[model samples]
Target: MSGMEGPVLVVPGLNGSGPNHWQSWMEALIGARRVDQDDWTRPDIDLWSARVADAIVAQARPVWLVAHSFGCLASVVAVSRLADRIAGALLVAPASPDKFGITARIPDTPLPFPTVLAASRNDPWMKFMSAARWADRWGARLIDLGEAGHVNTESGHGAWPEGLELFRQLQASAPAMTGPLQD
Candidate 1:
């Protein structure tokens, strides 16, 4: 939180991060808010991204997105048109766009804000190489987690300190924002 000048929004994927999930822990640890979606079972990028975008817009200042799995995909899409209000982003264990049949919807160009994408070699939702490719496409810095399964609570990653450090790094790397947010 040292370098962050605004709220941190946590976006969870699929069923949404449970109470024991790292996203929940991070939210409590750093006073971050979660972007609650209307439907967790459905992987509708349009609906999910719209919720994320609205959450960011509602923030009084710039925001940093901490997104996981399918939430990562939605977050990127949500920020595409609102990058100026973003401080940065830390995307972990992003689900494959192909798996959800939304590959065409995800942007192929670099993200407008500083971003870090963490990927695991053994995540069932997406191949390691596929994550690497997406990272490259988004011009995000990729971190290899080496066998960490989805980097979720089921993978035994509750209260993950390393992930917190990564978020800090993203904050440090983000360019500082000043003044009021523009409409």
Candidate 2:
């Protein structure tokens, strides 16, 4: 297996992932580090994006971002500005809210690099159909997981195998468009 090129950074939702959260499991699999933010608990999009960008630069070169909930939102917002810096992204359970001052900011466009959106059908944070629609808008491959509430530990989804399979799929489907000129 190829040694990891860049650290796979994991971004948690509003509350952040606890020990049992799926993102934590992902950290174990790929040596992922969280997107460090100044204020993690608050849903401040701009600050969150800035933190993501900074963390992306510091954590790994040619970074492959893996974000969940609010973290996913932060990544999406920053990726367009950091296009030249990223290889690919794996966004899961993005926190899109109409009242939290972020819903209007989400792009109706697809991200430049290879990307995927894994959403749950019964997530308290997002409706399945709405998440699928966002995926369609962003031109991301959508994996509709049935009844996986929020796809977090609260939903009884600690270390989800299916989600991990989806990550493997993303890694396999897309080639990293990074590194020095490898002739």
Candidate 3:
């Protein structure tokens, strides 16, 4: 995972992160592009996954994902079909679409690549326990970052240095070495 160049797609939550948001800040810092979602504020789950798959296909090299909120679920839905194209993924403060104890729209299959699930203890949009369960199901490394509600601009993490460090850690993790990165 050390030397992979990428078109890392920063997938934001409902409404997506604006230019001042952390995802935008991170995208610039990493020399990558945003997903440029047509409409993330109210996406159909299957359509969202399709766009993610399309983004993965559009990349010239290995693509990494940095997903926030419900975008995390979209990325998860894509994991099965896009694993060959993805280098890894970093899921931050996943907001469950299934708030009523319904299963997520995404499949529970293990992603065939490196992944980190960063969960907050006090995110108003999500329950940490449910996030943990998803992490286990996806076989992602669960990082319990103490209460930083939603881990967004409102959470005092606008230019979060700690989150940057975690992203580095995710990059240092093992990548799927054998597969050819998708176009």
Candidate 4:
């Protein structure tokens, strides 16, 4: 499993995952730990990235990141520093950094570990094409989830069984390359 033997880390977006959210449901089903950001509603990209790094280092076992919306941006930034410890990542419905008015530069460096980016065609946070472009830039396998709004609780994704399957896919597959796949 390489460094992929640890518990999954569930990272939520914006205001944090409510109890009824899919992320919360994932936490229970997969025994995943939520990266409890110090500030949830108002996020500082660097701070969130640091928190993710801290979470990865704190774990004795390997870690797989499950990040949704804005949390996806944070994970990508943190992975630049902690790629050695990551097994894989599942990024779902990433929000536009510009929309949130986050000034911190989103890293364009391709991630070292295996990653799957799931994009919803009808997501309000970002255009599907933009998300697909990001997936390509990050060297992640893109999964086009047609018309699934935001893929959040409000999007009627309380259980998100399909997402769970995608997460499992990441676990089963070995990283496609060693070190960063591309610049």
**Evaluated with lDDT, which candidate comes out highest?**
1
Give the poorly placed runs of model 4, Cα more than 4 Å off.
1-4, 102-104, 175-183
For 1-183, candidate 1 gives per-residue lDDT tens digits of: 244678899999999999999999999999999999988998899999999999999987889999999999999999999988888999999999999899999988998888899999999999999999999999999999999999999999999999999999889877776456866
Model 3 lDDT per residue over 1-183, tens place: 373556678888788887777888888887766765787667667777778888888876678899998788778887677677788889999987675243545678788888899999999878999889889988899999988899888877777777778887777775534444533
Any runs in candidate 2 off by more than 4 Å, and if so which?
1-4, 178-183
- lDDT of residue 1 for candidate 2: 33
Candidate 2 residue pairs in backbone clash: 123-150
Q: How are the candidates ranked when ordered by TM-score, highest leading?
A: 1, 4, 3, 2
User: How many backbone clashes are present in model 4?
Assistant: 0
Query: What TM-score number comes out for model 4?
Result: 0.90
Candidate 3: TM-score? 0.90
Residue 98 displacement (Å), model 4: 1.9
lDDT of each: 0.93, 0.77, 0.80, 0.86
Question: What lDDT tens digits, residue by residue, belong to model 4 across residues 47-151?
Answer: 898898899888775588999999999888888887877889999999988886763578776888788999999999999999988898899999999999999
Worst 10 contiguous positions by lDDT, candidate 2? 174-183
State the lDDT of candidate 2 residue by residue for 76-99, as single tens digits. Answer: 888767776776787888776564
lDDT of 3: 0.80
